[model samples]
Target: MQTPSAADLLLAWERGLDQSPTRRALSLLEACLPGVTLDRLAALPIGMRDTQLLRLRESLFGNSVAAVSECPDCGERLDVAFNTNDVRHMSVEKIDAETMEPQTQAHQLHTGGYDITYRIPTSSDLLVISTADDIEPQLALLQRCLTEVQQNGIPVQANALPDSVIAAISKDMANADPQAQIELGLVCPECSYAWNALFDIAAFLWNEIHAWAKRMLHEVHTLARTYGWREADILAMSARRRQIYLELAQT
Candidate 1:
């Protein structure tokens, strides 16, 4: 999918203001990936989905991702900066010819006298589990992804697995899809308390897009008030051109 146009991105941001992060991410992908179905976006593995969002973010904004975290010991805020490529998982996802999207393979694991074949969790899986009542999200995700389970050559349900076995499967899943669980190792300069932080690309990118859309709306309003240009006309103009006009209008 190509980089989304400003108009398309603005619309996506507007529509996503009330949606969940998962739905927002899928919507953003749908806006950018023309001809791709929402079902396909929902089917994307979380890691692959985040990888694509990271690429789009780098293209739209820049290579650097900035985050703020508070120190646990001293309540001091720290600014963490990293390049987009740094957190990207090393696994190379091959593109599917039919859908023009990345194709993911099922992973197999053998642990605690159990054998299992499972696929990575997708957005749809997360969405479905999130709304269900009286269910552990993690366990629900595990159950959804597990395509087949066998214990000592006997088939069994995922929920029947013990905690240790489930933990092992979770660890294996994390290892296989590193991008799905990004933990930033951070040390506070004030207190020297070291900790790990999760950097969610979907939320981060959506925040950026939201901010950009807000700023663009202000610029559009200014230009329209000063020069009477249409909103569509202003957005259709190049970013550089629009900025120039905004400057002139403000002056």
Candidate 2:
């Protein structure tokens, strides 16, 4: 994906304002990775999509990701910080080192007299499950990813399989697509409560963009009012230059 310019991100944020979280992330990818169709991006395995979003976060902010959560036992605030590489754990080819592209591959699971072939989930799979009111979302996702199912060397339906086999599929999927989910282990200093926190790079990156766009817009307002500069001209200035000009405007 191409690195997004400030103006490009601003446009993406605006377009994503009214969208759901899934669609919001798609908006960012669409703006940054031109020539890639939105449908193709949506079809990307969730981990690959997240890898791209993580790259975007590193580019716009930095490698360090700082976050806060409350302890469940004591309600104490826990501050967590880590580097981007922490969550980037997957096979080198599965997640390309140079291009950061994800390779989607089908995997096999043989257990409880069942043999199953499945692929990692994509954003499109999530969208389909989200809109299906008649089925359990998790079950729907599992069935959607199941490319083939067999029992006793005979073809079988995924839903007919035992829950144990279903769980095996889930576990294998997690292993195959490590970047799709990230959990941070945290221990509260007060109560010593320990728990795992889920980290979503797409949400995290969007929030950073949201805060930055607000600050930049405020700076633009200040400069526009002070010197009658156009929005385009204001956005064209380097961030450091904008900060200097804002300081001058205030003075």
Candidate 3:
């Protein structure tokens, strides 16, 4: 995927303003990968989809990612800095030419007198669970993921599985797809407390894009007022040229 032009960025930013987080992320991906259907992209395993987003993020922004979160124990804010290489636990092999689908290893686990075969949860799976309220979301996720489940050499219902069995499946699923949920080790200097902060790349990237769009709009406003240039003209200028104009406008 190539870096988005100023027009593409602004168009995406405007379109994503009223969209849900999932929709916003999908829009960004759509911008980078033209001709790829959203349904096909959504069908990819969450980790696989995130790997693409991370790559796109690195291409558009940079490799370094800085984040801040409050310490649950003491409410102290902690700053964490890392690179894209740190959280990337999975790699995409070649895409299938005929199907255009990414190849991934299916994971299996044997526990609690049962054998389970499953694949990592896809964005479509998460979208389904996001609307579920009848059962626990985790259990719903597990049920959706179970491709095959056998107890005592006989097939058993996934919904009827015991809590212990479900817990085991959860642990194994997490191990198999580490990129699904990224947790950061954070320490608070003020209170000597530590906690794991959930790092969501989609949300983090959206926030950065939103902030950038707002700042760009402000710059356009200032420049337009001073020189009567159109928004498109201002955005079309290179970042260096825009900075120079902004500085000159400040005088």
The best candidate in terms of TM-score? 1
Worst 10 residues of 3 by lDDT: 91-100
lDDT computed for candidate 3: 0.83
Residue 32 accuracy (lDDT) in model 3: 80
Stretches of candidate 1 above 4 Å error?
Answer: none
The TM-score of candidate 3 is 0.90
lDDT of 2 at 165: 81
Runs of candidate 3 exceeding 4 Å displacement? 92-100
Model 3 lDDT tens row, 23-99 = 78888887787768889888777767777788888987899998888878888877889998988885434455334
Model 2 per-residue lDDT tens digits across residues 62-166: 899889988988889888999999888764336544443457677888888888898889888988898899988878998899988888779988778788887
> In model 2, which range of ten residues has the least summed lDDT?
91-100
What TM-score do all the candidates reach, one by one?
0.94, 0.92, 0.90
Under the 3 Å rule for N, CA and C atoms, how many clashes does model 1 have?
Answer: 0
Greater lDDT among 1 and 2 belongs to: 1
Which residue pairs come into collision in candidate 1? Answer: none
lDDT score for candidate 1 against the true structure: 0.88
